[model samples]
Target: MLSKEELLQYSRHIILPEIDIEGQEAIKDSHVLIIGLGGLGSPAALYLVAAGVGELTVVDDDLVESSNLQRQIIHRIETIGSPKTESAKASLESLSPTIKVNLLTQKASPEVLNKLDSERFTLVLDCTDNFTSRFLINEWSVSNQIPLVSATAVAFSAQLAVFNQKLQHACYQCLYSNMNLPEGNCADQGILSPVVGTMGTLQATEALKIILGLNKADTSFLLTYDSLDTAFQRFNIMKDPSCSVCS
Candidate 1:
């Protein structure tokens, strides 16, 4: 039921056998919530918006800083003092005027997530940098049975994974224990600009695949990438029976 403009706009996607008109429709019907606007969230948001997702709700409390420009591709020099959420919304809408971009200019909280979940978010993308927010988002996704795509990039390395309540797989909390955690973020640890971009791009791909019903298998593996070595690694994610969130 695409308009002539939509059909022509998404012609490349509709032409592909993997994502024909039906898949494009599903893409347009999906509502994705992204919880960050930094390195990982930047490219993920751009690709998802360009891919014609029906609606996007982006959450970020930070303002644009000069240092962020190197990795945060969604913001510009003129927006350096702007809130990340407002800046990202303006940028995304500029890309696709028809796409809906909701802005939450504050850190996520249980109450806020509950309100959004009630409105029926199709899925969530955990693009946050800190473990606190990741864990919080993971718990919400798990409890609500919404699938989550989580990604991280720091110090030339990045990680990506999908966690779903419907699958018999490890939730983010199962793998990310307090004792075993990533040390620092790009601010102190240092990261190549494109390395974070790569991770964010991959995050969007997985999210789109899930929304299109193309990912039939449980994609719970911990996928890691090292920009320096140009290497990729995947490790199995075994569900911890004692996982408080998923158990």
Candidate 2:
């Protein structure tokens, strides 16, 4: 049950017919894990916390740098040189004191990821940039039967996808069976600031929908955005018959 303060705090959300009191309550009962505190993870973390997710675990071993302020909105000029996880925890908790923000100030190593499996997280956001991190996170999500919201941004383009093993959808690997595409490293390839933000906010939107048991896709679908045209495209992702992760 929500306290009077909470009910008042989330009055805006409760007013939405799609997300009424029960949906707000479900949001309070859902726990989410977000990997990376970069451009994509920043907005996702901020919104999820502000929306009152039951618990949020953030993983990032990087430190806040001046370069990050261009896109990673969760960190501040004062937080420069501090661990990203610490910076994120401080910012998120300040947004919603009732929500617990767990910090993993270490790398997203297999051991660390495995320990999280016991938590039975309701969903995961893969905001990491590289295919290696995405592949690893996808494998973990598939094995744990947890849905994953993955996003990537390079230059002015971004892609968003959700993979839910419980729904038997195609895993992330099915989208990119090879690492031949342009990598998502913003340092290597320049990016427009809002490009990543658009996808990150979408990731948070899809996650909340899943938590509220609304419009959860039964099959995998990928959403792509082009800032130049201000266009959004959706494509189906079929599960590869030989997919090693979610075959």
Candidate 3:
């Protein structure tokens, strides 16, 4: 049952026909795991907390840096040199004190991933900046029959997708089988801050929709955003028969 304060806090969500009290309650019961606290993970974590996710487990090993302030909106300038998960916890707790936040100041090692699977997290948000982490998360999601919201942004472009083995959808490996793609990042190739912000925000929106069962079938499609052209492209993604994870 939603308390009076919770009802007021999520009143807007409760009013929606698709996400009335039932969906809002579902959001409160869902447990989401977010791996990464950098550019893409920052806003994703913030919105997920504000939207009333019941329990959130955030994992990141990096420390806050001055350069990250440009796009990592969850950390403060005064938090520089602190662990990102701790900084993010402060930001998220301040936004919604009722939600439970578990912080892990370590890499997404296999042991950690296995533990998360055992705990039966409702879903995973893959906000890491590297291909290795993305592939590993996708493989785990597929193996565990869990849903994964994955996104990537570079320069002025970003792409997002939801993968679920249960849905028979395309996994991240289907999109990028070769993890050896030329290495590039915001530090070296340069990224428009809002580019990652756009993808991160989309990741949060998709997570909420997944939890609420809103437009759930659209998980088969990939949404691409081109800030340079101010356009969004949507296309259906078929599960690759050769996909090592999904197939």
Q: Best candidate, lDDT-wise? A: 2
In TM-score terms, candidate 3 sits at 0.95
Which consecutive 10 residues in model 3 have the weakest lDDT in total? 111-120
lDDT of 3 by residue, 73-175 (tens): 9999989999999999999989998879999899997788887644558889999988888888888888887788989888888889887666767888887
**Candidate 2 — worst ten consecutive residues by lDDT sum?**
176-185
Clashing pairs in 2: none
Badly placed stretches (over 4 Å) of model 2 are: none
For each candidate in turn, the TM-score is 0.96, 0.96, 0.95
lDDT of each residue in 1-247, candidate 1, tens digit only: 7789999999999999999999999999999999999998999999999999989999999999999999899999999999999989889999999899888988988877877753468889999988988999999988888888999988878899888666656799888753577679887888999988998999899899888888776547789998889999988787888888888
Candidate with the larger TM-score of 2 and 3: 2
Q: In candidate 3, residue 167 scores what lDDT?
A: 74
Q: Model 3: runs farther than 4 Å from truth? A: 178-182
- Candidate 1 Cα misplacement greater than 4 A, ranges: none
**Backbone steric clashes in candidate 3, count:** 0
